[model samples]
Target: MPRVVFLLVPRVHLLDVAGPAQVFSTADDLGHPYTLTYVAEEPEVATVQGLVLRTETAWPSLAPDDLIVVPGWRGPTRPASAGTLRRLRDHHASGGTVAGVCAGADALGRAGLLDGRRCTTHHTVQDELARLHPRAEVVKDALYVEDDRIVTSAGVAGGIDAALHLVAARHGPRAAGEAARAMLVHMHRDGTAEQVSPLLRWRSHVDETVHRLQDLIETRFAERLPLRLLAEATGCSERTVTRLFSRATGLTPLAYQTALRLERAGHLLERGATAETAARAVGFEDARALRRLRARPGRTMHSKEASWTQAHP
Candidate 1:
């Protein structure tokens, strides 16, 4: 079983700790073996939310596959104790993965782990993080960044996305998707804020009708789903469904379905599936439709896909 350890500090933000912790806990509930541990410099730590949390003062034995995460705290950055910094550096040197959320990146920087590493933090502190650690390449407008074995997130809800990304990387997209669904997290952004998963994109609104239609379309993207069936599912007229969906997601129902199919087809292609096989599996009539979509302007491969291609080619 992989162990996930969270190192808490004074005035730690509750959501920064809970969000990622919940993701891993949900994954564990879904049969992914994960042991979560919490540690702090003292036996008790106070949160910015005014809650006192109890934690272990002694560190646990960790392996290469285990993860250590530092949740951000409130106020200015404070340097960690020498012993704590040593533990973080030694764990990473032993090949364990380390993550810093929001202001937690400051901890990693003080330990010199961010030197030459690409990292991100809450947008409010991005400039300060860059100024403090000149050697670290601080990424802006990114939900999270992973370099070497170091993961840094923008903090708050962005920690959930980073945790989901880590889950997808460790397990698979299916597992991550399952966890997200269980948590009602229908939106999933990639590393950059501008890019997101097709299945999870355009879902930031609170329109119940549109959400109902999206749920239906996502589950049946590989099947023939006409506008009438979608409208009937939401008890709305075809025109209303079309109008609401377009307004909420900025894409027509058909366009949304097409994006899902195209994304699935891209994944299949990356896994060595032939064009015909992928197209048929993703509801394309044939390879021609898939080819057209792939060849269309502004339909270029995502950064993750491009990286896969470069490695495999």
Candidate 2:
């Protein structure tokens, strides 16, 4: 049985910690043999949504092959201390798997473990991470990514998906399926699946302009989206499009357009659409351009055969 350690920080999100815990702990019902524990920088941590939990171990006493799961941190903009970074780096160097869910990727990035590795975080912070870590291949279209020994998830619910993926990787597909079935969730969304694939769900952004522009961009993904034209379509100035787009989506107009194109291309690919067909459908001139866009490491295009196989096999 693999030992799993959930690493917590001050003001961590409860769901980020609880979602995976509930799934792993379900094994208790089956009388399976696995050890799961929560550890913090200190002995106790408070969740952002007003829950407090106590830890059984501190960071310095971890063992190898013990999966260290990092929950989302309180804020993305805060700096991680050198001591914390050293511990995380050393833990991974000693052959342990470090997994981060949602903003937890922020903590891994701070530990310098994500440098030059493919990784992801909540979509709202993709551009910020890109600006901060140019050496890292920061993916915007993935729910989770596993590169070398590091794993990362996109946002809230993504934590669950990533956790399930870890279980699958450690045990097998059936184990992951059982875990998800036990929890009544989907198993094995390709690691490459977009963190923000459901564009419609982006309405929850704090800014109305941001939400409106996101809707407009997604609504017209197939159309040629000139900045001036998009501004005109939204009844806002081009400057407003440039500014609000970044604030709400953490991406500029061009980046947003690219994201939509990639998403549509993925949808087409999953339906077994040919590269040529998928490319044309999503406004890419040809399959070559679509390939260029999707050729980034740590992402894959699932064929229609693969999609149906996973669904029905």
Model number with the top lDDT = 1
Q: Mind giving the per-residue lDDT tens digits that candidate 2 earns over 76-193?
A: 4353467766777888999888888887887788888889999998888888777877778998868899999899888678888888787777767677777778887744466777
- In model 2, the runs with Cα more than 4 Å from the true position are 27-32, 57-61, 76-80, 197-313
Candidate 1 lDDT, 37-58, residue by residue in tens: 9999889999999999999999
Deviating ranges (above 4 Å) for candidate 1 = 77-79, 194-313
Give the C-alpha miss distance for residue 307 in model 2, angstroms: 24
Candidates' C-alpha lDDT: 0.86, 0.73
The residue pairs in collision within model 2 are: 141-194
